[model samples]
Target chain A: MASKTALYDQHLAMGAKVVDFGGWDMPLNYGSQIEEHNKVRTSAGMFDVSHMTIVDVTGADAAEYLRYLLANDVARLEVKGKALYSGMLNEDGKVIDDLIVYRMTDPGVSGEWFRVVVNCATREKDLRWMAEQAARFDVALTEQPELSMVAIQGPEAIVKVKSVLNESRGRLIDSLSVFQGQESEGWFIAKTGYTGEDGLEIIVPEDEVADFWRALAEAGVAPCGLGARDTLRLEAGMNLYGADMDESVSPLVSAMGWTIAWEPESRKFCGRAALEAEKAAGVTQKLVGLVMDTRGVLRGQQKVIVEGVGEGEITSGTFSPTLNVSIALARVPAGTGDQAVVDLRGKQVPVAVVRPPFVRNGKKVFS
Target chain B: MSDIRNELKYVASHEWIRDEGDGTVTIGITDHAQELLGDVVFVELPEVGSDVATGDDAGVVESVKAASDVYVPVSGEIVEVNNQLEDSPELVNSDPYGDGWFFRIKLSDASELDDLLDAEAYGELCEDES
Candidate 1:
């Protein structure tokens, strides 16, 4: 049996096709997956992302602990609501998970408070790792399973989400800058989303999530599912945790090098020495985006043949509903060039190797 | 319940066949199959002049989620393939029984039709799988 989120009933009520996603019975789609993907690109769409795990870290040594535990420096967060995307790596430089860490308290507050949201499938190991790391510091990790998250994304996402909030909450939402999240009236409204669109990932208590979902639906926000979320994130060039990288893949080759903060070399974060060694040894492969202008869809594990270089495998691939093209992210040899061929079921089809973010802000971005 | 046309014959593999009564049969995936494979993005059809035996791999259907192999139900030479799907594969989801038909086959043996299932038997198969 699979676990159910707080919005599971609401999902079934809305005619969602439920599937097992990382031990959670979640909605794959309400109707057409492509339509749901388009909803986020064109109008507004809401996703019940309650299956993601949220861990609140608070203590006197919170900042110092996170700075050492994560690859990115949290001390760079100048404001309370600012968010940072970082890769949590193991001692050997392998990426354990990618997450968003938010500064939950004012800069000068006595004790540091931060909120981190990790992937649902990696909940057990992530929590265990955080706990083990916190043992040396004064930080306390609290798992907030009682809260549920809903991401409303698109061009009119902010307007639709604001319409469901009170005056002060709406004002707080309006005041939020990109990649910022603020708490208001027992809710955490963040102007951050996985989709490359203006949106909010609002976290509300379990008791209030259904009503909130209903209100958003009444406001014409289409109820999207995991399928749309995956496609939207892929189009946005965001990497999925398990698909793009795992415990065995190094962050240096997973297009996550930017997430590492190497400045202030004195501050030793976890996996720093290993990453430094890997970087010094010369990175071999890098993650790149593949575009198929021909027929058929690009799928994971498909062999990408780079003409004089070497072969690579697709990490994640899907038909871009926004661009009407098949796009993929693959880890190819460092010498791979602009064009390659994919063995799409015994047929070697040519593909263009371009930077990711195939679509952004409802428009085709890559040249 | 998915649409199960009584006038058509079905295989356990979720394909529906229509005996055109002219030594040929029109074949397409059942509505249930289309519903399971949501949002078809690409459809690979068998060549118009190729001969295939029963249970041979005839084509492919790639959805947004995954790809599935389309198998032939009866041995025959491929007569016609739906070209419309190359541009608009969603037809498989929107009208699986009609415009979403995969191909037409010139039947080599009409006796193979007896092995196919009726609407009721096909419905039971779908029911048991679910």
Candidate 2:
């Protein structure tokens, strides 16, 4: 049997089609995935993101431990509640997992705390890796499995969330900046989301999550499922951990090279040497966005043929609800030109290649 | 629960056929099939002159979640395809019986229609799968 979130019953009551996702039985969609996708793009939609793994690292060496464990430098988080997206890499510079680390305390302070949220599918392996790394430092890792998360996203998301929150908590949320979070009334409210929209991801006590979800539904925030989440993230050009990059893939070729902080050369994070070697050896492949205006949808694992260049494969692909066209992320030869053909069931369909983030702020960014 | 039209003929594979009495049959996926596939985003139709054997893969219907093959229910030559689905695939979800019809086939074997299940039999098949 698969695991269930706190709101599983609510999902069933709302006519959700549940599927096994990352060992958890989660909602794929309630009815129409396109409607849910449009809800997030036009108004507001809420998702049960409780399947994500949250870990709190606290100790005298908390900051130091994160610096050594992550590909990005956490030392740059000057203010509390500031979050940084980083890749937890293996010794060979391959990404084990990509996570968001929030500075729970002031930087450079001993006995500080940092909260890390990782993908649920990689929980077991990621925990073991973190424990093994923490053995060398005076840090303690505490998994927050007792918490349930809800991500409310879109143009009107903040207002809808504010209406459902208490006045004080609402004010606290209103004062938060993008990528910032704070704990209040036993809840961690963060102004962060994966849909490239204005929203808040609230972490609530497991027992209270159902009521919160109900309140959001009553407040007119559509209860979205993982299907909408995937499409929304794809349109925003955000990468899915398992599909876009895996343990065997390096960050340099995964469109995550910017997350690697190469400054302050003395800071030797894990996979630094290997990443440096790969960079020096010249990265041969790159992840780019593909748009198909004609018929047929682009799907993952589809073969992409770039004329005069080596073959590449799609990492993540879907019919974009926002653009009304099929879009995909493919890892192609580094020097591939601005166009390629995707083999869709033996039919060669032409696609235009561009930098990712096909849509942002509910608008098409790529021409 | 999905609506099973009594006037139509269905196959175990979830396709419904309507004999137009002119040796050509109109075909579309059942309501249950569209429900399972969710919102249809794209549909690839067979060419007008292509010959298709019963149970052979004739076309495709892609939704937001995944793609599914629309199998040919009876042996025939493709006579016409729903071209509107190329630009507006949601018709399959909104009106699977009328405008959402996938293709029209000129029957090579009219006896094949007798092999299809009536509304009652198709309903039982859907129940078994559920």
Candidate 3:
């Protein structure tokens, strides 16, 4: 049987179409997925993202261990509550998973703590990998399964979330900057979201999650499902762990070269040697965004022909609800130009190869 | 449970046909099919004044989740196609049996309708699939 979250009953009561996602029963949509997508773009929507795995890392070697384990430098987190997006790579410099790590405490604090949230489908392997590496370090890994998370996103998302919070919690929301998360009254509220909007991702205790969800609903926050979440993340140009990249795919070619902290040549991180060698040898493939103004949806695994350049396959593709057009991310030959054609159901349809982030703040940002 | 109109005939593939009593029939996907497809973003219909064979690959319906191939139920000449769906495909989700009708066909073999499932049998098929 698939596992159920704290809000499973509430989802059923709200007429959600439940599907098995990563061994857990999650809502796909309440009714119209397009409406849910529009709601997030125009106003506010809340998603029950409790299936994400939360790991607490604490020890004297917390910072150092993470700096070596992840591609992103942890030393750059100069302030408490600051979150950093990183790609966890295997020894070969291939991406294992993408995660957001938050510095939970100050640098000088005892048992310096950091929190990392990874994808639910990759939880077991990630935990095993972290422990295997921790055998040589002084860090401890603890999985917090007692927590449930909700992401309130869009223009009015913060206001709706704040309406349900107490005075001190409300004050905390106001004080937070982007990419900042803080614990208040047993809840971790962060000004971070997968959707390209000003919002909050709040981690609450399992016992309080249902009631909190109800309160947000009463405050006029639309209940969004995983369907909307996928489109939103894709629109924001964020990569899905398994779909965009895996252990066999290098981060350099997966649109994650920026996450590699190449500065300070002395600091050696995992997969650094392999990445450096690949970069020196000249990376062959690159991840780029594709836009289709014509009919038909662009789906994953479709062949993209770049004419003079080599062929590439789409990693993630869907119809953009905001722009009323089809958009996708594909791994193409590094030399590919701005023009390409996708073999859409046996028809070679023209498409424009552009930079990612097709939409930001609910507006089309891609030219 | 999805609503099944007793007056309409259904195919196991989820297409519903309504006899217009004028030697022609209106065809559309069933409500159960629309519910399964989530939000319909685009719909491809057969061209008007075209000949289609029974069980031929007719058109396609693209949803937010996936795409499904729409099949021709009976051999006929397409008399008219729904043009409103070009700009508003959500009509398929809003009114699957009414305004969402895909095409009207001048039946070449009206006997083909006998092979289609009735409302009761179609309900049973949906139940079995679920």
Candidate 4:
């Protein structure tokens, strides 16, 4: 069955090229992919991310449930409207998904409530996993199907968003610090994004999302699709869960060591034992970024070889539009970041290994 | 919008062949091939004067998404190579049949054109893909 988002009609009205993405009708692109990529780089671009799954966990045990479920501690989100980025792990300490959890302020409504947003492709599995965990606890978890989501990203996103709302709300939105959120009426505005840029992800009623999308489009925001979104995120060193890591890949090797909070020994989370064991024994393979020097595009599944270790596969690879170079994220040997070679058929091509984030905020992070 | 010129023949892998009106033939990839690959970031052209059998991998074409092998439509000897793609690989995406034509060859057998598909048949073959 093909599911339709609130912006489906709007996309059709704009003559977008629609495709089925994870069972939902999505706009692959309004027209030219290169044009959309250029728009996000030079100006502003908005994506219809309503296909993503949004869930709300309420009750006193909401934070406690997240602490037990997520690899990162949600107790660090002391300030209301602050968002935390964390990875959900399986029993083997392997990352199931990476998500952003927003702690909403509810001093009067119904107590402290937190909004959890996950990838569109992993919606069902994420919800199922979350529900199973909730069944073990007393947290009230509800999927937010009533609300639609959109992400306006890039350099000119702020300017375009500000033009839609009133001066007060506009200024309030611009005043939002990174990883912060605020609710105005039924609209939830959070300064969060996957693209390495200063932007915001806004949530509102389903019907209202189309209207908001129109207003944003009219305000000069380009309607970008999954193509540009993939390139943009890859250039930012962000991982797409199913492509970069899944239930079999651990965060210790997925470049998520900093996200794990280990201070409080009392707070034992799911997969903690395995992660500790892996940490103590040492992980052989780690995720690293590759910059191809041969001018050919690097793609996923391409073989990478270190001196001693045999071979590794490219987890996620793409041409970095921002850096104007072919880059890839690969799971190579732990000590292979210094240098590596990607097999271009029978020929071995030298590739520079470095910390990812080839580009950020419209600037090339790699030279 | 590239019409299959009557002088050219095509293969299922999306390469075109030209029966050079002699005992030789010329070959290059089709426009549809480059379109599927998006912009051509790199081209690994085969060595000139090398023996290329029919359906043999002449070179590799790398795009934003994946890298694919360009197969020889007919057995031949590489007579010409388009060094133009060495710097401006986008030409393959912009003009797969023209300036982006990968290479030309002097065929071991010009009668091999009979084994290739016609323009209309090639179009039908492409349209059938999922």
Candidate 5:
């Protein structure tokens, strides 16, 4: 039996096709996947992201503990309510998970409090890892499973959300800049999203999530599912934990070198040694974006050939409803060409390799 | 809104055959097969001159989500292939019973048509799967 979200029963009432996702009963889509995908690309859409595990690290040692635990430096966060995306690494330098750490300053959410939102699929592993690190630090680690998060995304996201919140609270969130979060009305509202769009992700108590979701939906925000969430993230060039890199891969070889902050010689972080070694030694493989010229859609684990160097495989691929083309993120040899071929069944289809994030800000960024 | 014309013989696998009254028999996948496959994105048919045995893998039908092998119902020589599907593969999703016909075979055994399921039997087979 899977744990149900606060909106689980409500999802069933809406005729949602519920599936077991990371031991949680969640909606894959309300009815049609293509329609849900299109809704996020064009207009405003809301997603029930309550399954994501948000852990709080607090006390005087929060910053030092995070520096030891994550590959990225949290000291970069100076202003209150600023969020930084980082890759949590294991001792071997393999990516444990990629998540966002929101620096809270309102005393209620931060000061001593630092929030990290991890993927649901990696929730258990992430929790365990955080505990093992906390046992070594003077910090108290607590998992707040009582909160529910709703990601309202697209060009009209802010407008749709602001229309529903309390007048004074709405002003606070509306005044928030992108990549910034603030505590208001006992909830943390962050202007962030996985989709390549302007949006706000609101964290509220579980009791209020269903009503909030309904309110957003009634306000003309489309109800999107995990399917669209995935395509949107892939289109943004953000690598998923299990699909892109996991226990065996390094940040240097993976598409996460930028997440590794090399500045400030005094700051020591986990995986820094292995990352520096990999960067100096040269990485064997890299994750690249590929757009299929052929008609068929590219899929995960499909074989990719880089000519003389050898073959690689696609990490994630799908037909972009926004781009109207088959786009994918592939893990190929670092020396792979501007042009490569994907083995679709028996036939080899040519694909153009370019920088990741085929689409950005709900528009095509690559040819 | 569905028509099960008596002139065409149906197979339990959802394949339909139109007996030309000549030696050659034209065949195509049924409407139910196209519906099960959400959207047809690509198709690969057997060579026109190749001899195919009944129940052998003759071609490939790829939908947006998955890929399935297209099996030949009756053994014969491949005569004509649907070239238009190569340009606009979604034709299989539109006119599956007509323009989406996969391939036509010059019959090696016309008696094989009698072995196929009729309209009533094919309709029942669809219900069973549901």
Candidate 6:
């Protein structure tokens, strides 16, 4: 049997199409996926993201433990409520999972704390790995499964979210900078999102989530689902962990090289040695964006033949609702040219290679 | 709930056919099919002069979630196709019975139409799937 989220009844009442996602019965769409996608792009939309795992790390060695566990340097977070995006890697420099770590207390102090949010599908593995790493450090790890999360996103998201909150909480939300979060009245609100739009991701106690969701709905936020979330993230050029890369592929080739901190040369992170070796040897493949030039849809696992170079495959592909064009993220040879041929049903169709972030802030960012 | 016209003939695969009264038939996917597909982004129509057999794969409808094959209902040569779908495939979701029609076929055998199901039978089929 699939598990249901705290707002499952609300989804049913809103006429959502429920589907099984990573062992959780979740809403795939409310009515139209495209409409939901457009709603987030144009106005405001909300999603129930309670299935994500939220782990709180606190102790004297919290920062030190995270420094050794994640590929990025968590020491860069100087202020409380600051967040850092990092890739949790195995010994082989392959991404175990990508997550956001929020600093709950100041650095270099005993009793410091941090919060890590990871994907639900990799919950067990990530928790196990985190515990194994924390064993050596003086830290305590606690999984907060009693929390429910909601993401409100779009250009108008901030104002609309304020409309549903108390004056003090609304003022706190207004003061937050991008990639920042703060705890207020037992709730954690962050000005961060997967979609390339202004938004707030709020994590509240499970018992209080239903009322919060209803308030947002009453405030005129469209109820979005997993379908629109996927499209929005793809259009923003963000990677889906399993589909884009996994334990077999390293960050060097996964468009996640920026997440790796190579400075200081002495961080000694889990994947530091392997990534250093790969960087010295040079990488062969890289992830890039693709726009179909013809009237066809680009789908994942499709063969991408780079002229006079090696063939590659699409990591993620979809019809971008904002651009009204087919876009994809493909992993191809590093030396691949600006144009490649995609084998669509045995017919070779041309595609243009470009940088990612096809759409941002409800506008086309790519030419 | 979707609107089902009593005058049209339907197949188990969710396609509908209408007799044009001049030895020809207009074909389209039922409204229920479009609702199941979410939003129609692209539709690949068969050539106007191509001959099709009943139950053969004629074309495809690609939505944001997945792609579905539009199967032929009655055997015939395609006479006309809704070219507007190439630019605006949402027509299939907005007006599936009229402007969203896929193609017109000059029936190779008009008698084959009897093999299709009535609206009531098709409605029962949809209810079972749900």
Candidate 4: which stretches are off by over 4 Å? A9-19, A30-32, A106-110, A309-311, B1-8, B18-28
User: How accurately is candidate 6 docked according to DockQ?
Assistant: 0.70
Displacement of residue B62 (Cα, Å) in model 1 is: 1.0
Query: Candidate 2: where are CA atoms >4 Å away?
Result: B20-22, B48-51, B119-130
Tell me which residue pairs clash in candidate 3: none
Tell me each candidate's TM-score: 0.98, 0.96, 0.99, 0.91, 0.85, 0.96
The stretch of ten residues in a row with the least summed lDDT in candidate 3 chain A is A104-113
The DockQ value obtained for model 2 is 0.76
Lowest-sum lDDT 10-residue window in model 4 chain A = A104-113
Of all native A–B interface contacts, model 1 reproduces a fraction of 0.87
* Each prediction's DockQ against the real complex: 0.89, 0.76, 0.88, 0.53, 0.29, 0.70
Runs in model 6 deviating more than 4 A are B1-7, B119-130
lDDT of 3 by residue, A1-367 (tens): 9999999999999999999999999999999888999999999999999999999999989998999999999888989999999999998999989999999998767878999999999999999999998988899999999999999999999898889888999999999999999999899999999989899999999999999999999999999999999999999999998998999899999999999999888889999999999999999999999999999999999999999988999999999999999999999999999999999999999999999999999999988
Residues A207-286, candidate 2: write the lDDT tens digits.
99999999999999999999999999999999999999999889999999999999899999999999999999999999
lDDT of 2 by residue, B21-55 (tens): 99999999999999888899988899999999999
Which 10-residue window of candidate 1 chain B scores lowest in summed lDDT?
B58-67
TM-score of chain A of 6: 0.99
lDDT of 3 at B13: 86
- For residue A186, what is the lDDT in candidate 2? 95
User: What are the chain A TM-scores of the candidates, in order?
Assistant: 0.99, 0.99, 0.99, 0.96, 0.97, 0.99
Worst 10 residues of 1 chain A by lDDT: A103-112
* Positional deviation of residue A58's Cα in model 3 after best superposition, in angstroms: 0.9
Residue by residue across B1-130, what tens digits does model 1's lDDT show? Answer: 7999999999998999999999999999999999999999999999999999999999899999899999999999999999999988999999999999999999999999999999999999999999
Give per-residue lDDT, candidate 1, residue A348.
97
TM-score of chain A of 4: 0.96
